[model samples]
Target: MLSDPKSRFKPTSTAVADKSNILSALKQPYSNAARIAGTMRNAYLTNGSVSKVIDYYQSHPTYNYNIYPVLGNKQYELNDNVRNSYIDIAYYLRDLNIKFFAPIFFKETLIDGVTFWYKYQDKDGVGYMKLPMEWCLIRGTENGVYRYMFDITKLNDETVQSMPEEFQNAYKEYQSNNTSDTNTWYNNKYYYVQENGMAFTFDYNSLVNGGLAISPFASALTDIISLAKAKDNVNIKDNLDATRILQQKLPMDKKDGEMLISAKEAMIYDQTIRGRLPEGVILATTPTELENIPLTNSGTANAFDTVNKGLEQVFFSMGGSSPLFGGSTTSSNIVKEGIKKDANWIYANLFPMLENYYNSEIATVKTKDKLLWNIKFIRQSNFTLHDDIMNLKDQLTLGGSRTDYLAANGFIPAEIISKLTFEQQALDIDSLMVVKPTSNTLSAKDAEIQKRGRPKTDNPSDDTDRLDDEQG
Candidate 1:
């Protein structure tokens, strides 16, 4: 009998408390940093244009990595623990929620300028949870030395209970020490100080505004507000246009060059228009005629176009191109080339930081396992695969070392050569292969000419007939 499908893997639990509510309730009046980070996070979650740019990076290929042995002039025996740790790291990353974390990572690093991950050990070795931006407070002077303040109240009672004994005891102590003044108590006790390595923080850019990174979307917020207002105006106009108004012209008397109508008669007409007309109707008595008027004209028809233009500005502000949205955009090639440039930038700037982080974290794990050889990480991704392949081709053509190129392509040249040699000898396949004529090997025509002794005169054209005669 087959086992239950749920038994195949470990179950994951989510936090029960509403973090937004906690932030709203516990937020200090002096700081808008949490609110600003919340806004940026919410914009990424709710806005299509913003999400699209982040999604492009989030959906980018997971890194391909190699663990290289780094032994510096020291005689060390490579043990099974050292070798297996590499496999353990690979599996841990594979099982981790990288797809979910990647978008948050990109959003924080690129826009918010900092990101935090709560690292913990589990049955799967190590796991990371992306901490809420609003609940996180950056403290300390230097960027490297800065510690993160994570609000413990953001986690519900169930989550707190599920935590380890140390965190549980802290939470209980906080609960016992709670006071009437929520602000002071919350500010001082609710926030748990996460030490440097315990909580992973990537502070890629310079900090500002009370150690809070300014959002890239801050400039585009005005444009977004304008777009919203414009959309509202357009909707209002459309609603007005949807209802047709009736125009009634009562008979008027021209007395002393002045058009006049009885007030009673006008009141009666108004009453009739209001009662009998379907909706959106008005009555007026005048010497001239009256006609139903439309709310807009060709002059004001560009309202929607203006909205589109504003949207384009917002897209650019969000570090995205119009072509990324992919609807009748003429710049597919532009965005494609831009993607290449982005990949290059990521490799140059962002990847080094990630490499350092992983190397340090995994080294700690390996040390616990009594591993001797220190492992170095080499990260690659499919984003630059085409360029890498082209460069490799060019280099090989220019007489680059095959061993180096093969290693780059993730091959062992010695193993490959050994396998080829085995096939050549054991299978004897080389004996059956036909050799093609090269400059060193004489061709059939040249051999025949050489055998017949080069033409005495300028009778090279007759060599074919002579060869045929010689064959006969």
Candidate 2:
């Protein structure tokens, strides 16, 4: 009975089922099982589930608009918790880069191995400015080949008009080609110019996204920032709801009674006396009474603390210590150490990447025979002045020359050190020089006598001599 295709299998005293029959039912040539399996396989192969998810994320209209305006354009803005994180990181990175590797123009010949360094300057005397790495958008494939780079340039009407004709034309052409696109460079929008006028669209040997470079925080930042914003919204709504609850009045007494005043009269009474009640005014009320509302004291158990934890997570994800975003004036030793660790990590990883990108751009402008010099980024140490001073003292004590020690400690510029040495020598000579009083030098008494014409008398008294000196 079980083997029969028309029979439905059921547990009974006489019922029996075998593996062979079950297998036959499942694998039958014309059975519905094969059709169901084939359908699932086709769906998997076609990525039907994945496509639906992606479509929901990409095609949804609500996701396309910015929810917050104060933070800037929603597409480019981060959540409040991590909103300023990128800006802070970018600022530090840009400052460090500028401090260490403000571009220097150099020419090198391959044959003689001779190199000449020149201060970087534009022919127009506007000064050669290196674009900050933080302001650039790097996009590339998975193979470390940079495909497209965008330099974020803020141009106003006057500045745009003042730009060179070649740059203006190129910018206008770009705008004309991309007018329909939201990312176009019209008006105050960002403009993308070719690096050093090179036609090559891709940069080679870039570690992130083929050749396009990006902030270290770019990958994990968006989700964390969004989560933080969501938390803040939830917190605000919760607090508002709690406040509303607190504002509601509770019934103190229950009595079925008709009001002495009509609805219109009550409205008039409220409008007149709601916020303008005079002191000591009393109204007789026996049947109807209203109770004062009490505030609700719902404990905010760890809600804000959770938000803080999320912020810490964001900072950590961005290669920063939690204390950096803790908004505290002071931190513990552990936090300081964590910050130092993060700094070292950035120096080792981020600075080198940026340096390499700049070097690649620099190479493009160099002639074939001119050896390209890679710019070096100096990572500023967190050592305090005390540390440097102590180190300087130690070096001096260890027989290091004063000039070398001072130079190594960066106490004075090399050019000014010579002048300082000359001044020190002059001061030493002045200190060493001393004139001995000669026997012919006039005494105070003799000088007074000479000034007062040898006093009034030959036997001048002590008081008379002093008075004469004073008079003289």
Candidate 3:
């Protein structure tokens, strides 16, 4: 009655067509979507305000991260083997140089809504190479898993040869198939294999749309265009304002509009005026009047202001505060809080996504032994150190461990323990500290020595003895 239950799991015709079109579109030499991606990248490169917004995203305060084992959500001390394994992972991560790539990733993701990197191996070990967003496409998802494709035709021969053998073979087979069928050449002639580690994507816009990644700047594209036009207009107005015009007059005769001067004389006068004037000066003559005018405030008096407002609007549309690009004195507090919120949201979402992708796709690619570990990237800049200290203090007040306080405040617990042991045993630093008794302890011990209640000792010898005893 259900008519083959497995048939329901198959991809629909529309989904298949979409996937095919996505591949074909990206593979084409001049796809509009790819061009738009290129344009966004170029804007970030060329436009100062756009660059500032993107740099803000990239320049968020960075934090150190460590990988910890997830041992069933129970409280247990990490054994030496596990701790050493985590340390090894830390060293591997440092060698991987992910910190160097992270800013690039942030910039590209802000522009393209997605970033791609190719994973490869050589004598030095596993490495990642960033691939152009315009050359990459998603082939759709299978069972909630995404599969990616890259336009091999866009890549050079050396890069293609450097890929994994599986990917290389697939590319060669596609080339052979296409060469055999010259009449039916396809736009999606490039090749890719499924589930290969050759390429992976950082989809910042994952699941919001289908497989395709829509740029974050997509919605603000119209504002960006408008802002560009506004800037051009401003430039034109500024040029006009920098220009000057001159007017000259000659004495007129009273005989009923008789020419004050002959045409030849007028031409001579014009030449004289033009030759006398410097650059950016224009002149005109009339018999009745003479005036000189500079082209200041031409076209519109408020054109510069208009440009400024447009810039602010563009920054706002790009999900950035006006102060980030320039000055916004009136809304400084609001913008500061807004930026803080944006930082929190981005750190919460973006960092975790990157961490997870690195852990699953990169850190574990070389070996399976790291499957149990995850690199926890806590953003240190999300909160100020003072705020963190206060929170830790509150936590300590509520019966949290002092070791937690030390660890969370960027101190290594084991290193602190070892340092303290050495300081006590070798340096004898503890003996230098004079431990002062608390009020309650001192009161309980020296109750009889209250100066108001106790009389002074009259005997000089006894007084000297008491002083010696008190000093000791």
**Most accurate candidate by lDDT:** 3
Model 2 per-residue lDDT tens digits across residues 224-263: 4344454766576576445521121222334545564566
TM-score against truth, every candidate: 0.58, 0.39, 0.64
Candidate 1 positional error at 77, Å: 8.8
In candidate 1, residue 202 scores what lDDT? 40
lDDT of each: 0.52, 0.36, 0.58
- Give one digit per residue, the lDDT tens place, for model 1 in 1-472: 1223433212121221233433442344125444444555565665666667766665454443334455545636566665455455545544444444544555566544455555666565444555445555555432234445555666567666544454566576677765334433346554545432222334433234443444445555555556655666677667666666565665555565443667687777778667776555444544466655665442346678877887788777665667657634665688777667666656665555555555554454444345533222223346556566567567888895554444446433233344666779887877777664443455556655555433323345643443444645
How much is 378 displaced in model 3, in angstroms? Answer: 0.9
**Candidate 1 structure, TM-score to reference:** 0.58
- Per-residue C-alpha lDDT of model 3 across residues 180-269, encoded as one tens digit per residue: 333322345634434433222344344444335645775555566666767778888878887877777766777886676897898899
Could you say which candidate leads in TM-score?
3
lDDT for model 2: 0.36
Model 1, C-alpha of 229: deviation from truth (Å): 3.1
Model 3 steric clash total: 0
How far does residue 381 in candidate 3 sit from its true spot (Å)?
2.4
